[model samples]
Target: MELYFLGTNAGVPSLQRNVTSIALRLLEERRSLWLFDCGEGTQHQILKSPLKLSKLEKVFITHMHGDHVFGLPGLLSSRGAQGVTAPLAIYGPPGIKSFIETSLTISQSRVPYTMDIIEHTGGVIFEDKYFRVEAAGLDHRADSYGYRVVEKDLPGSLDPKRLEAYGLKPGPQYGKLKRGESVELGDGSWIHPADVLLAPKKGRVVTILGDTRPCPGVEVLAKDADVLVHEATFMEDLAELAHEYYHSTAKQAAEAAVRGGVKSLFLTHFSSRYKDVEHLQPLLQEAKEVFEHTRLAEDFGLYPVQRST
Candidate 1:
């Protein structure tokens, strides 16, 4: 799994950054892509990357902010134009469904695919064989939310050498063992999966939060996450302003990452005032002081989510 930051600026687009949109690429795992937000010019950003709109399977909108959702209609229309007919699923807070429906209707854009809009409150919103997505309310000017994506634990691999030592050749028995089932041999002896299989690999957790101040929902969604993508829309000097606007400072984001016990933190949604890397360096330094494993998210940056050992 990987996260592709299409736009990382807050509020409005700047020459250095666009807005807030992230693509969670699950190509290797599921051969599809999940978009976190679709800010204005997000489609243009995708054009500059290696991503394809046809692979977009799901979209999770964090809030109704213009920067977070202005490009949804255009993206959907473009997907149809590209001959993609796969069903799409969208999950967001209340009013998201109405917003999407209204935009599409008013624009007279007809997407040649079924779209499922799920206006979730808080709690587990989606669950399938491979992953589960949970949502929690966040403290923002609008009714924003955060998502906790939990991947299911994968089954351990079978020990070929160990099975060979048992006088068993690779066959259907290996499949059973891999599935944690015991297999009986011709000699009436049984071999348990634990005897021939390695330990099951733990799944990863990724927390993606919308614009917000430090809140209880942040802790709930970020707890023990392998990667926490939090909004850092202000610097420490503007902590009071950040709180007033229901936005987080870089320092606050890193502190939250520490409190949530996340393995790594990616600070995004930067304020436009930080025009260039020179200005942005201080934000990264502030976050690093609080959490050593913090990274500043940049536009078009692709971050791989490595499997936990």
Candidate 2:
């Protein structure tokens, strides 16, 4: 799994930062991509990356804020111009349908692929055989939400040596054994799959919080997550302003990550007040006081998992 930051600014776009969009690339046996929060100038961010518009299988909007969703219409229209024929599904807070409809209607944009709009009330919004998505209503100026994206538990690894020890040669019958069924060999001995398979590997969880203040939604949604993408809209010195604006500070974001039991914390949605993001490190270090593995995000940077060395 890979997380590519399209934009890392909050409230407004900066010369160095676009609004807010992150691409979750599942580049493995099953190739798919998921996006969180398409902020302003997000389309321009996509242009700079090696991402395909057609591969955008799902988009989860954190809120209806202008900076969070103003780029949707343009991206949707460009999806067709770029020849994306795959169906797209969008999940967001109330009024998302109207927002998309009005944008398309006013601009007279036509997309060849189907667009599924689901205005959620905060719960398990989507699920499939391979993945599950849940949402939580967040404390924001408007109706906002956060999403937890979890991939399905992987199948158990098959032990070929055990099969060979059982005098079973590789063939179509081995396929049956892999499915946890008894396969009859020429000697009439039954082979059990469980005897030669390892336990299933746990799936990774990635939680992305929309613009909001410190709340329980993030703790609940991001419980034991492998990666958490939370918004840190301000520095610790601006705590009062962050709360007043329904945004979070670097300190608060880290605390939430600790409470959520997240393995790694990625802080984004930085305020444009400071030209250098490095200035926020001292504030983020405050969060490390609560959670050790915290990182301040940068635009166009990719954060991939670093497994055991």
Best by TM-score: 1
Cα RMSD to the true fold for all candidates: 1.3, 1.8
- How does each model score on lDDT? 0.94, 0.85
How close is every model to the real structure, measured as TM-score? Answer: 0.96, 0.95
Give candidate 1 regions above 4 Å deviation: 180-182
Q: Against the correct fold, how does model 1 do in TM-score?
A: 0.96
For candidate 2, lDDT tens digit of each residue in 1-309? 889999988888888788899888877725878889898788889999998887888899989999889999999999999889999999998888999999999999988899999999799999888788999988999998999988777657777788778877778877786676777667876767777777776787888889889888878888988888888888788899999999998889888888887899998888888556666677678778878999878888988854221
Any idea what lDDT model 2 has? 0.85
Measured by lDDT, the strongest candidate is 1
Point out where model 2 deviates above 4 Å: 179-181, 306-309
lDDT of 1 by residue, 203-280 (tens): 999999999999999999999999999999999999999999999999999999999999999999999999977899
